[model samples]
Target: MPIRAVVFDFGGVLFDWNPDHLYRQLIPDAEERRRFLSEVCSPAWNLQQDAGRPIAEANAVLVAEHPQHAALIRAFYERWPETLAGLLPEGVALMERLEAAGMPLYGLTNWSAETFPYAWEHYPLLHRFRHIVVSGREKLIKPDPAIYRLLFQRMAQDLPALQPAELVFIDDSQKNADAASALGWHGIHHLDAQTTAARLHALGVDC
Candidate 1:
């Protein structure tokens, strides 16, 4: 089926979010920051919060495991806002083009529920979407098939009779895109806004 709606993944696709943005200043030394991020307040550890674990609980667990890095681990969430460098202009422009063209837009993101409020309040563009399914709120992170199914189900409520094939999903992670593809949606493994825009045009999307 021809694509009718677009689902965007937020982190790398829309927001320039990276721990390095915050950690570089805190750790100063590149290797030390790398080790702290990797061996301590790691991506895998942070993902638990994205999966709905409480931030405090997550911090406590990590602190217990790596007492030496307790302060840094706490700072991960304490100074979370510093992690978001800013919005990606090209990505925002693409979303604007799609919205202006009357294409329905939605969002699917694996973000911590505790922190998502900051993004929602600070980023006005996010308010443009018809709806957004946050993995943190749902406790289902990608590339989990269940989260993809939930997105489809939620979209169906608004766009009745929408089919899996009628939707296009854009995500920075190849595996997340592949998961959507497995569910019969057109998945764009978005590396950059230009590439993603080209793919969308090739798929006959309006923008």
Candidate 2:
């Protein structure tokens, strides 16, 4: 079946997001910054917030565990917007092309609900999506079939109900892509906008 809808992942796929961007300014020293990111405000620790734990509560837990890095931990949420450098122009162009082709667009991202508003406000392009399923708001993360199912359910309400095979899921994470593929959805492990555009064209998307 032809893909009827295109689903996009927000962080690595649409925009660049790295804690290092904010930590480099805060820690200064390369090694210390690396250590702080690895040991203090780690990805695993940050995933808690993405998993729907309130940023304040998550920060408090980290602060209690690493009192010396309390300020740094707090800064993770306080200055979260700094972590999002900017949108990928190539990706933006691809989205524009897809939109022009009349392809329905959707977003699924594992971003902290508390910090997502900053991105939502900063990026007007995000408003173009028909709907966005935020992991934090839903308490579900990618690579989990449940989240993908939720997206399908939500999209089905207003749009024609689509089978998994009729949906094209795009994400920078191979794991997430593979998960969607397992459920019969067409998955694109987006590496670059140019290559992804070609892939979409080959899949008959014409974008």
RMSD, every candidate, angstroms: 0.8, 1.1
Residue 137, candidate 2: Cα error in Å is 0.5
> Which residue pairs clash within candidate 2?
none
lDDT of 1 at 203: 88
lDDT of 2 by residue, 64-117 (tens): 999988888898888888998999888888999999999999999999888888
**What residue pairs are clashing in model 1?**
none
Model 1 CA lDDT for position 66: 89
Task: Please tell me which predicted candidate would have the highest lDDT against the true structure.
Answer: 1
What would the per-residue lDDT of candidate 1 be over residues 91-177, giving only the tens digit for each residue? 888989999999999999999999999999999988999889888899999999999998788899888889888999999999999
Query: Who wins the TM-score comparison?
Result: 1
